[model samples]
Target: AKLRGENGCPWDRKQTAQTLVKYIRNETEELIAAIENKDKENICEELGDVLYLICMITAINEEQGNFTFPQVVQGINEKLIRRHPHVFAGTRYKDEEELARQWEAIKAEEKREHRQAAEKREP
Candidate 1:
């Protein structure tokens, strides 16, 4: 973020979420292409680019008081644990189809919870 401060690069300081999102999309495509081509070096480079954009976006949101980086990490960690009952809870799945069903159910539950929270915050 220092590179986006007062004495930072003029271009970097001028970037917004909208602009950074374009870079994120492009980097994602490059990563996908690298995977398709089985290019390990390009895959690593693209992944780094994607991570940089994500971090930059998080920093911008942090500046706006929207959320902290730790909140983002915590949310993903909790979501993973909540979704993977087979791995974390010793629950057995009969097959891939059953595992997928369980995953979708967990996702739907998460969506419902998010909607309820949003409704609670609405006037």
Candidate 2:
């Protein structure tokens, strides 16, 4: 937050989520390369870079009243719990293929529900 405060870095303060997309892509590619090469040090550094970008984007959105970082974290946490019912909710899957199929089905249902909710919210 200091980096974007009233007396903060002008460059950082000027950044928006749209402007940070390229940096996010670059950091993600570097992270993938680090993982592919099994470079633990580079992987850690790239992961931090990616996380920093996420925080920055979240901060920008919060500043614009779109959403906050905690909301984003909470949403993902809820999604993880929702999607991993086998581990979290005592749901069982026979095998990896079955688990994958169930996961896809859940994802499709979520998408359909989201679309319905969006349609209701529109107009």
Candidate 3:
């Protein structure tokens, strides 16, 4: 983002999240195509592009004082650990279907918690 600072790249400096959304969406589509084509090299490149966009968005959010990158990382890490009790807490599922159902349930619970947190944060 230094490239988008006071004396940074004008192109990047002028870009907002709305402008970058298209690029991120395009990169996602390219990544999906690469996976469908089974091209390892293209997949790796596309994945890198997607990661770059994610970081860019995070930086933009941080600059706006909305949230930090660490918060993003922590949220995902916590969600993964919470969702996968089988892996993290030694809880077992009898089958793939059962595991999927449990995963969805956990996700719904997390969504509810997030909604409540947002409500609490609102003025």
Give me the candidate number with maximum TM-score: 2
Relative to the unseen true structure, what is the C-alpha lDDT of residue 36 in candidate 2, on a scale of 0 to 100?
100
Q: Against the hidden true structure, what lDDT does model 3 obtain?
A: 0.91
In model 3, which range of ten residues has the least summed lDDT? 3-12
Alpha carbon lDDT of residue 54, candidate 3? 87
lDDT of 2 at 29: 98
TM-score, cand. 2 vs. native: 0.95
lDDT of 3 by residue, 1-123 (tens): 796789998887888889998999899999999999999999999999999888888888889998999999998898889888999999999999999999999889888988999999999
TM-score, one value per model:
0.94, 0.95, 0.90
Against the hidden true structure, what lDDT does model 1 obtain?
0.92
Query: What's the CA error at residue 56 for candidate 2, in Å?
Result: 0.4
Clashing pairs in 2: none
Compose the digit string of candidate 2's lDDT tens values, residues 79-100. 9999999999999999999999
- Our tally of clashes for model 1 stands at 0
- The segments of candidate 3 whose C-alpha lies over 4 angstroms from its true place after superposition are none
Runs off by more than 4 Å, candidate 1: none
Q: Candidate 3 — which pairs collide?
A: none
